[model samples]
Target: MTTDPQTLTWFKSSYSGNGGSCVEWAPMQATVTGIVPVRDSKAPNGPVLSVPSRSFAEFIAGVKGGAFSAT
Candidate 1:
């Protein structure tokens, strides 16, 4: 099934405490499609990244697990 990129809904994470370095994702779109559409919150008109649902999930898990270092 094909989905319209323009119709996708987007939202930022609660953990993204008003930081300039925040990204938004279309969870509703991901539910309808297997791909998660992500984009920089600071630049909504900028390029978007479509990641696979499973991969996005893993990335989120890694973030929560602190697998990535701020430094």
Candidate 2:
């Protein structure tokens, strides 16, 4: 499904804690389409990164599991 990114509502995680470096995602769009739209919260009109739902879920899991740790 195709959608205008501008029309979709975007939101950041509460864990973001007011940091300007947070990333935002459109959950409604993700629900409608299998694609997850991600973008920098600092730039609302900036380019969006479209990730497959399964891949996105895996990435989130990895984050929760600390797979992407800087250490």
Write candidate 2's Cα lDDT for 1-71 as tens digits: 36777998998988898758799999888888889999998888889999999999999999989999677
TM-score of each: 0.86, 0.89
| Model 1 global lDDT (CA atoms, 0 to 1) | 0.85
Model 2, TM vs. native:
0.89
Q: For candidate 1, lDDT tens digit of each residue in 1-71?
A: 26554677779888888668899999988887788999998888778899999999999999889999999
Q: Which candidate leads the pack in lDDT? A: 2
Models, CA RMSD each: 1.9, 1.5
lDDT of each: 0.85, 0.88
- Error (Å) of candidate 1 at residue 41 is 0.6
Candidate 1 versus the native: TM-score? 0.86
